[model samples]
Target chain A: MRGTMLYAPFDIRFQELPDPVILEPTDAIIRTVATCVCGSDLWSYRGITPFTEPHPMGHEYVGVVEEIGADVTGIQPGQFVIGSFATSDNTCPNCRNGAQSRCIHGNFMSTCQATSIRIPLADGTLVPTPDQPSPGLIPSLLTLSDVMGTGWYAAVAAQVVRGGTAVVVGDGAVGLCGVLAARELGASRIIAMSRHEARQKLALEFGATDIVSERGDDGVEAVRELTKGIGADSVLECVGTAESMKQAVRCTRAGGSLGYVGVPHGVELNGEQLFRALIGVRGGPAPVRRFLPDLITRVLEGRINPGKVFDMTLPLDQVAEAYAAMDQRRAIKVLLQP
Target chain B: MRGTMLYAPFDIRFQELPDPVILEPTDAIIRTVATCVCGSDLWSYRGITPFTEPHPMGHEYVGVVEEIGADVTGIQPGQFVIGSFATSDNTCPNCRNGAQSRCIHGNFMSTCQATSIRIPLADGTLVPTPDQPSPGLIPSLLTLSDVMGTGWYAAVAAQVVRGGTAVVVGDGAVGLCGVLAARELGASRIIAMSRHEARQKLALEFGATDIVSERGDDGVEAVRELTKGIGADSVLECVGTAESMKQAVRCTRAGGSLGYVGVPHGVELNGEQLFRALIGVRGGPAPVRRFLPDLITRVLEGRINPGKVFDMTLPLDQVAEAYAAMDQRRAIKVLLQP
Candidate 1:
């Protein structure tokens, strides 16, 4: 089997690797049908998050089950499926509470950029499509593995409601999806904060009612002005930088909420500021599994097409190009064919 | 008029001061019915929160309207009222959103300790009781001005629901009130974290089903053990220190919420820690005005008795002794009469 590995900063290698097999009774091996590079992948690829050893990369994929462990139930071979970037047994206390990302028996998936991947907790982690999806739907379905679901979680966490306003503080793929999620959740006003023309256009297409190109205090003022000086009822922070979090917090109205999904790098929140602003904050890795079923249905019903986030597509062997293109801002996201 | 003044640390003096008069059309002068020493007053009393000059002290009060400016409406002279520590123009955006503490036109009341208090936004700030209450009900009704309302806000912010579990961190007047609030909200298992035997007894009387005397990590461990190792569904942080905030965070289950009513001092939250725990945090000065009507009704109906927290009583002239009792931890809370 062939897979992608990061040898060092700015170095991605797609080469021959041993095929995956069930290592535990709860595991299943799936043959990758499609995979993709994520914005988070750039963290290690840029060496911002250093690594001592070369490691397998990628956490998003749509695949076809090849074999299942003896103890695996509710899942069978030859089925097409989509799974969360984080694996969960789905019955633990946290999972039952809709926080599968924090499930006691969970592990983040890090080796999905391969021909064949071994998935633990298969019965609980993977949700099968009613039938094998057509090629066109594959891209959209693949997004359900992380970005789209994360965006949905962001909207849910922000407590976005019908007839309310929302502010999305990032223009990345996830942020674009968040615009769609907020719209679906019935936010009457969706503001997308973006300076890039192309991303701004995509945001509008994804249901953004307004766009603010300014950054920092100016951006906060713009949002406040748009919200009648009260700020948005909900704000989705798709970037984990301190600046983005601060902007998101300032964009939310008193009694409003900010939902942050981006992995934090060096973000610190002041208790006093949050208290004075009366903002409710909830953030973390997206509990993708919790939203997988509903999102999958939404995609299959053709109600959403999040695959539009994939601006570029490449062969799985060109995995290096995928990382480089996203790193250089040449691609919003790259879908990979395995 | 006479008022309590804090000249410096440990230098509280009851002295003659200028009588308060209406300065705004919306202002209403109230004769003090009852005012009390608050835990927060000790911050400045202890010189932890410094003041540049001698200042009038106190924020909690249940008073009778003595005079009203021309524009004041809905409240009449001689009407008994219980108002929030923070006055608000309830028509403001924040107030309409149920966060009156952050109202656009609002101010924290600091002159209530005096014989006469000038309240801004009189029509919006004060809620009249059904009628003048008997002396026995005054203390309980007075609590709606701050402590009891704050505890109610903590439970409300934590999203307490019937049959859920709650953990109250801090055994001060507000925390004891939180135990009562949790019970009123229908929490099946209310855990009160208190090291003081007297406070523990009061908490149990307020409907706490369990008490954990441990502090810090040991306290968190004890809460976890009682909660089936999942932590409580809602945790109230009534102490503002960083340690209390951290303990409150750890005691909440993944996807649970922490409502911190404590006015934070030097508290900084690491975004990464909160992200990994999937904890939702919301805190601030309680919007007591929002809860005044409901709480007052509860007291009038004899459904609640928060006045028990005031174990000691003093004449208004003994304001200095009231502060001393609370400062020395000799009284849970002290009620004052003019």
Candidate 2:
């Protein structure tokens, strides 16, 4: 089977890798219908996160079940499914609490961007939408796999109250979607911190009421001024950069909450400051599995169009171009049709 | 008026000071009926926390309202009240949300140790018992002012779950009461780290399931081991020392919550570690005013007896020895009568 293999630093190759097979009783093989590149993927692509092992890349995907293990339940062949980057046993205590991504049995799904992929914990991790989704719904449903769920986690973790202000720190797809999420959660105001016009415009479309084109303390101050000196009641930090995390922390009002979903690089928390202000901080990789069902319904209902974050789309043969475009800022997110 | 004042390190003197009057429209002059030394006072008495300015020192008090300003509503003169150290309006958003300590108009009682003290925000800050309590209930009621509230805040902040493990990282009155708070919050397992005999015994009575004599990482490892390889679901960090903070962080489970009410002397948060672990940290000075009503109800109903933390008592003239005994670790918590 032809697949994308990450060999080493700045190295990705289109090579013939053996097709994935069901090695466990809960495993199932799915033919990838759609796969995409993620910002976290860019970390390794930029060589900042060095890969020591040669492995198949990509974790986000929408697909059709091709085969299933004898014990695989609920998920059947010919079903269209979307799964999170991480696989989880949906029945674990953590999973039952709507944090499947932190399920005690949660593990990284193998290379999902490929002609065929194997998934474990099929019943618990995968959400099968309708047998067929409208062409208009593909983009939005695609976003549910990772970006949308990640954004929703940020908004939820921040405890974004209805009729309250929320600040989003990051211009990435997750950040923009966080704006949409804050709005969905009933936040009356959403502030996006970004200078780029394209990103800012998308943020506005997603539901941001204000934009602070500043960084660090200045960004915090701008948000504070906009929120009438009380600062944001909730802040969603989607940019994994340290500076964005700092801004997120500084921009939250005393006794407010900060929901950070970005894969933090070097962000530091000043305990004294957080303690004195009484602000709460909570976040992690999105528990996409927990959110996939409602998101799928909302997307199918055409209530949300989060797929707009995918500015560029390509086929399997042009996967390299998709990576390059996203890495060079030519695209916000790249979708690959396999 | 004769009142207690701390001139400097090891110098708590009873001297003549101005009789507190209603300085604000909402102010009330409370005749100090019962006041107590706090664990935090030891920090000042031992000079670990320097007295930047000379002032009265006690913040834990249950008093009789001697007089009230004309504008002070809800509270009448001659009522016995058990109020928090910090007075709050209780009508602001923060106060309404059960964070009265962070009320917009609240003030920390940094200098409330005297015999006759003025209280601001009289309406929202003071809660009167159904009837003036007997002497035995006075000490227990006084604990509601700070230490008890701090412990309750820690437990609540930690999100202690029923039939789940909780690690308490301090052994002061607040820490011991945190063990109680965790129990009240339904934590099935409470592990208190302490070497002191009295506090540890009280912690057990308060429902601490285990005790860790070790400090720092060793204590954290012990907690993790007790939780069957995962750390505690909730951790109540009552001490603000850097060591306690580290233990608090280290002992919490991944995706777990830490309720830290410790007043950090000088502490920092490692954002990189915190973000990756997805730990939730929340706390500040206990919203004592918010919890006062409920705490008073519990004490009146005999559901909780927090006065056990106070092992020694002295008259107002002997307040100096009260501070000295607490500083020398000869008492868990001390009570002073005026």
TM-score of chain B of 1: 0.99
**After superposing candidate 1, which stretches have Cα over 4 Å from the reference?**
none
Model 2 misplaced regions, further than 4 Å: A7-11, A52-55, A92-98, B91-93, B161-164, B212-214
Q: Report clash pairs, candidate 2.
A: B58-B113
The lowest-lDDT stretch of 10 consecutive residues in candidate 2 chain B is: B269-278
lDDT of each: 0.94, 0.85
Estimate, for each residue in B290-312, the C-alpha lDDT of model 2 and write its tens digit: 78888888888889998888899
**Considering every candidate listed, which one attains the maximal lDDT?**
1
lDDT, residue A152, candidate 2: 95
Residue range B55-167, candidate 1, lDDT tens digits: 99999998899999999988999999999999999999899989899999998999777787889999999999878999999999989999999999999999899999999
Candidate 1 structure lDDT: 0.94
Candidate 2 docking band = medium
